[model samples]
Target: MKPLVVIPARGGSKGVPRKNIKELGGKPLIYYTIEAAREVFDDDVICVSTDDKEIKEVVEQTGLEVPFLRPEKFATDTAGTRGVLLHALKFYKEEMDYKADTIILLQPTSPFRTAQHINEALEKYHFGLDRVVSVKETDANPYFVLFEENEEGFLKKSKEGSFKRRQDCPKVWELNGAIYIINVNSLKNEEVSEFRRVKKYVMDEVSSIDIDSELDWKIACSIYYNIIISRNIDSK
Candidate 1:
């Protein structure tokens, strides 16, 4: 299926300021997502939607053109991801006259996600559905470990289950903020937040690392360094 890959990297990052352009694993963080997209699809089909001029310039240095700077309204901290995606789809359709059956949203935060993960998710994607979002098995098991305060201020299990051990409970998944494959027609008709029919693309914990805070960034760095060290040792 023909797909348009959109990598949204707006400026005004509060956590780890300028994170999109910040060096991670020896390169700009966004470069990882852009390169991964290029590995799977033609460069022309991959678009970097950024509101900051610096981000656009940095992305251009990677040899992939930034189709357009996202509008200021969509770059705000309160702006929803769905709006940014819709604007991108509109730009491609009206300006470039390029029509794609599906859109693959790859957030720059997920640097560990690679072309292989995207290709596997694409193989599982089918039209007429809302979306296929990447996820990882949640480390927090609500059934046995997590608790919520009741109206009476008493703690209660978040999810009631009879399992004696957390491992015995049914597995739960959470969005990894890595990849989202959406049906173009479905996206145009309804916002992604409103979609009820969604599928999950499960990824391992390390691959699902999404850097949103300084702690997360540090963890990513440690993981990256370990991988590099392992590869280098094997090469010798």
Candidate 2:
């Protein structure tokens, strides 16, 4: 089945301001995702769904085409990903006279997610599944220290478990906000939030870094620098 990689990058970023095009590790943050997608899929199938003309120009500078600028309504902070995905699908069908069997969402926030991760995830993906999402071992497990206030306002364990030690508790996974491979038919029929037959593609801590705030941006810069330094040392 043919796969299309959709990158949702709007101009109005409240967190870091123009975050999608913001420079990270000497390149626009969105450039990393675009480069990664290009490594796995042809440029024609990789769509950057954005409402900002500047972002569109930046993406095009990478030699990957932006089919069309997304509508203003879908670009809002209040907009949902479901609507974005559907709109891209509709565009491909109506305008390009092309259809994709699978839609892979590679968020620009997860800059560390690379082409290797995408290729590995696709290798594991098989037909008939609802979706495949990348994840990392969560630091907060519901069975452990995580808690929620009850109706009476007393704190209680988020999930019930009798394990005496945190280590003994079952390992839990959290979506790393990296990659999402969704079947087109399933996406069309149901919202991604409602998918049941989902599988997890595990990644390490560094690769799981998702930039959402200023602190996250700083942390990513540190990590990126360390990685580059490490690579340079290894080469020599």
Candidate 3:
């Protein structure tokens, strides 16, 4: 399958200021994703779509050229990822004459997601499917814990179920925001949220950690120093 890997790294981050390029474990946060993508795909097919020049430079440090600076309109906090993906696709198709059948979206926030995870997800994808997105089994099960307020301002279970224990509740998957292998034709026709033929690629909690807060950053750093680093050393 012809695939184009898109790594979306925007400059403005409210959760953690300058988060895309912020240093983590002695390397820029985006570096981990770029490195992982490089292992699975060629530099030509990988696109780092960023509006910030600093982000472009950081990506280029690894020798993968940033194709183009995203337009100001698509770089705002109000901008959606659908627009960014379309813009990148348009650039490649119109300017470079490269058309990709599949779009592999790798957000820079998930540092623990490695090349192996990407490959496994790709294996689960086919042109027939709308998307193969990575997910972790959610802790907040609607049948057990999740609730909603009714007209009387009373709490009610989000989903109607007679399950007495949390373990007995049906497993619910939470999108981990790590990997998204999308069908180009399906994406062109509708937004990702509208896709009905989506599939899940299950990932463990540790690998599914997506850093969007100060506490998340600390946890990521702790995992890097304590677990990931140790694993590398042990393998050697």
Candidate 4:
């Protein structure tokens, strides 16, 4: 399949300022994702879609081209990911005369998402499927722990179930924001959330970590040093 890898990294980050270029484990946070993507795809097909100059500079250090700074309209906090993807696709189609059949979205926040995870997810994708998105089994099961407030201001289970124990509840999958192998035609027709033929590529909790806050950053660092780095050392 002809695939275009899009790595969207915006400049403005409220939770952790300039998080895309922020150093994590002695490398820029986006570096891990770029490095992983490079292992699976060629530099030509991989695009770092960013609106920040510094982000572009940091990414270019690895020799991967940051083709274009995303348009301001698509870089805002309210900007949707669909627009960003479409915009990147448009650039490749119009400017480079390259049209990709599949779009692989790898967010920079998930540093632990290895090249193997990407390849595994790609293996699960085909032309007929709308998307193959990476997911982790959610801890907050709607049938067991998740709740909602009723009109009477009373708490109620989000989903009706008679399960007495958390383990008895049906497994719920959560989008890990690590990998998304999307059908280009399907994405052009509708938003990702509206896709009906979506499939899940299951990942473990550590591989699913998406850092969006200070607490998350701390957790990611702890995992990186204690688990990821230790494993790399052990493999030597």
What are the Cα lDDT values of the candidates?
A: 0.91, 0.92, 0.96, 0.95
Selected candidate, larger lDDT, 2 vs 4: 4
lDDT of 4 at 196: 93
Using Cα atoms with residue i matched to residue i, what is each candidate's TM-score against the true structure?
Answer: 0.95, 0.97, 0.99, 0.99
Residue 76, model 3, lDDT = 98
Question: 231, model 2: CA deviation in Å?
Answer: 2.8
Kindly list the per-residue Cα lDDT of model 4 for residues 1-21, writing each as its tens digit: 989999999999999999898
* Candidate 4 Cα errors over 4 Å, as ranges: none
lDDT string for model 3 (1-236, tens) is: 98999999999999999999999999999999999999999999999999999999988998999989999999999999999999999999998899999999999999999999999999999999999999999999999999999999999999999998999998999999999999999999998889999999999999999999999999999999999999999999
lDDT of 4: 0.95
**Cα RMSD (angstroms) for every candidate in the order listed:** 1.5, 1.2, 0.7, 0.6
Residue range 155-213, candidate 2, lDDT tens digits: 99999999999999999999999999998999889877788989999999999999989
